[model samples]
Target: MTTPQDPENRPPQQPYTPPQQPYTPAPPPLSDSELAGYGQQRPAVPEPKEVRLSFFLWLAGAILLVVSSALVLTQRDAALEEARRAPATPGITVEQLESTVTAILVFLVIIGVVLAALMVFFAMKARAGRNWARIALTVLGAAVFLYHLIGFSLVGLVIVLVVAAAVVTLYLPASKAYFDSVKRAG
Candidate 1:
């Protein structure tokens, strides 16, 4: 029945005191040697086997692309023969037709080499646990698979299978964990 306003009825008050806690000073700023040591520390998380396999698969795809380009270049005679069989257009001479076909083949080979280089680059990055690189490689794999499927050749089917395998491996749980660990560490 006592109110705070009734000073005669109020209980004794104690001085405000902060809760006791062990004193912990902030860590000192790292020295140049310490910072260098941090850089030298081994990655706590080892890369998953799935990621390694995926990288190897991507490398294989790149190799395949290189081999296909070489094959195309070597088959110039066959391509020329096929071109010769086609009914000649009124204005285009045989030399012109051959030159045009040669140009197109060269351009295709160049594109193949460039794409192969990209695949190798992405594979290396993905191996280093770059999530963006993994995603990019996965998307590229899917695109390649779809393109090959649409084209429907024996070689295309082989490429589709390889890319599909690589994409699947890249998305495996172990691979995801490795990528997540890299993200956390960075």
Candidate 2:
């Protein structure tokens, strides 16, 4: 015989409410020209022209080395013939002359191979968009220019140096962006 609670004093329980869904407003419609810009997105990074020039200089150097080596070999043979006919010098023997020629030829071959390898390495680095390669190339180009300018006074050296400088300058962030834009456009 328990007494019942009074309804007038009892409180009603509220129903559980789930979280509201996030409102994702519809995207604005794209216009034809504006939509095209999306497909024309630029690359994240671009290679510098200095990097390219450096590679080319390395290539030219290798080529010149080969040609010059050939010319030297021909001249060396002529000189060796002349020396053989001359009075036997006290300090020089045929064996020594032959050994010297062989050694020089071997050294030149080694130089050619090394230079070729360096050129390829730098070219690959430039293609891969390494900034340090650009710097390396600039230094290499400067070295070549100075070496040739002093010894040969060749205008090609001047041109290469000037181009190298220009490329380095033009590859600044703003210029790089411009280059990227042109690349994307094409």
Candidate 3:
């Protein structure tokens, strides 16, 4: 009966709430003008001269390998004669040595053709802006150069020098930029 059931004793009233926001649709796709503006911002890349030089060098190396194989085949008779004249080891006869020389020459010819084909394949891929191909060619070139250098013959030295030149060309600044651009574009 006192003070009309004390107002403070009543349950707390609910807090005021804001109305919910409606879901909005996404913006429309970019128009042609916007796309054109984006396209215009990127600078154009030029083809690197180093790439072309590398390709030509690889082609030359392949051709040289073919010619060298031909020369080796032509020298087979002389090689056989030389093998015959050499003093034979206790276990190996002159006939065996001659046959061995012939077999070695044939194996070398097959290797030369395979290597030439690989060189051409790598060169073509590198020309198409494949960074991996460029790297592969560089590594292969270095290996070839080292192998030929260790052989210590005039022809071997020539091959070593040519391979060195090709590797150097690939490392040029233009070639690096070309490879980088290709990677970015993809």
Candidate 4:
């Protein structure tokens, strides 16, 4: 009781201690199975490859039909002028040439427009995740293949075959199945 207090001898301050808090655990990351259930896999979505092929096919078809139609129209007037100068031609006539070309061009253009519309329709359906769109597009593409075979020579036929193959390949069963699942989900 007689000892004098010394600065150095003073009791060291208690070590700082934070107040206790409730223990909390972070939620675990989702597993692959959990993600699969939600259809988070990349392959679950419909691929756009087939849609692109369809669009290109429709565009080329439209251009060919339009150019052919224009050529027939431009040549029709010239043929008519020639026919007017001639007194008479028993079998051949400008009217016949014009009508024949016009008929052929109109038929080709109509077919082209129909196919193009179908292409756009299928593309939209595919984008909306319709499985049936795949089959429909495949059929249309096959039809295009046959049409091209009759309309085009060796080189053009080869090109059409390649495009058709690409479309059919891209819209395979796996992709269709994925789209079907997506359709069911919505």
Over all chains combined, what TM-score does candidate 2 have?
A: 0.44
The sequence of per-residue lDDT tens digits that candidate 2 reaches over residues 1-186 is 988879888788688899899999999899886777676433345545644454565565556645544544555676567667778768877899877766766665565455445545654564455545555655655654553442243444444555455446545675455445545655
lDDT of each: 0.80, 0.56, 0.77, 0.60
Worst 10-residue lDDT window for candidate 3 reads: 38-47
Off by over 4 Å in 2: 1-43, 46-61, 79-89, 142-186
Q: Candidate 3's residue-wise lDDT over 42-154, tens digit each? A: 32455588888888889888787777766678878987887778886789976788789989888877877777788899988888788898889887787566545432556
List the candidates' TM-scores in order: 0.70, 0.44, 0.67, 0.49
Cα lDDT tens digits, model 1, 1-186, are 954578777788998999999999999999997777685434557888998898888888888877776667776787889888998778998789889888977876786687778888988888888889888887787767654453355776676688789888998999999999988997
Global lDDT of model 4 = 0.60
Where in model 1 is the C-alpha error above 4 Å?
1-43, 146-153
Q: Write the per-residue lDDT of candidate 4 for residues 1-186, one digit (tens) a residue.
A: 688889898998999999999999999999988766685433345555554555465446445534443444455565556646768657876667667656765675566567656756775566556667767777777766665554554544544655465466546665556576777776
As a whole number from 0 to 100, the lDDT of residue 142 in candidate 3 is 70
Pairs in clash, predicted candidate 4 = none
Residue 74 C-alpha lDDT in model 1: 77
Order candidates by TM-score, high to low.
1, 3, 4, 2
- The top-ranked prediction according to TM-score is 1
TM-score of 4: 0.49
Candidate 2 least-lDDT 10 residues: 147-156
Clashing pairs in 2: none
